[model samples]
Target: MNGPALFYDKAAFRKAGLQPPATWKELRQAAAKPTGGRSYGLALSAVATEEGSWQYVPFLGSGGDLEQLDSAESVSALTYWTSLLHDGSA
Candidate 1:
C-alpha cells in the first residue's frame, strides 16, 4: 500500500563508493558488493500467497505476460526470480 523506497546503510555504501540502484538490473548489480566476508546485498521474505506474488510483480512487469506464461517475457521473469534466489541476491 505504500510507495517504494530504498532503505540502505548509507555509511556502508559511501565507504564502498556505491549508490542506490535505480532499476532492477542495477539492483541486481548493486547486490553484488563485497561485504568483506560476512553479509549479503539484499534480503526478502518468502511466503506463499499475496506476499510472494507481490514480490514477483516487479520482475513480471519488467518482462512477463499473464496471458502467455510460456512466452519469452514470462520466462525471463521466472528466470530472474530463480536466479535471485539461487544466487542469494534477494
Candidate 2:
C-alpha cells in the first residue's frame, strides 16, 4: 500500500550508534537525539495551510479515522506530534 516512508542516512545513523527505527515511539526517541545547533531529526511541514495538514495525514491516520478526530487514537497521534515539537525533534 502507498504510505509514508522513512529515509535516513546509514552513515549518520551508524555514527550516532542508532539503528533504524521500527516503531513510532522508537522514531520519536531517535528524533530527539542529535538535534542541536541547527540540526533536526525530522523535517516537518507545520505551516498554517492545507499542505501542512496534508503532511500530517499519516500521523492522524495512525490514530484512526477522520470521522472521530477526538478519538483516543487521534489524540495520541496529535500528542506524539506535539511532543516531537516540544522536544525540538522536528
The TM-score values for the models, in the order shown, are 0.74, 0.85
- Superposed by TM-score, candidate 2 places the C-alpha of residue 21 at a distance from the truth, in angstroms, of 0.7
Evaluated against the true structure, the overall lDDT of model 2 is 0.81
- lDDT values, one for every candidate: 0.72, 0.81
Question: Model 1 over residues 1-90: C-alpha lDDT tens digits?
Answer: 523445788887787788888887877787777333457777655678776566666567766876788999999988877787678665
Candidate 1: residue 58 lDDT (0-100): 59
- lDDT per residue (tens digit) for residues 1-90 in model 2: 335567897877888888999889889878877788799888887789876777777888675666887899988888888888888998
Q: Output the lDDT of residue 34, model 1.
A: 38
Worst lDDT run of 10 residues, candidate 2, spans 1-10
Please list the residue runs of candidate 2 whose C-alpha ends up more than 4 Å from where it truly belongs after superposition: 1-3
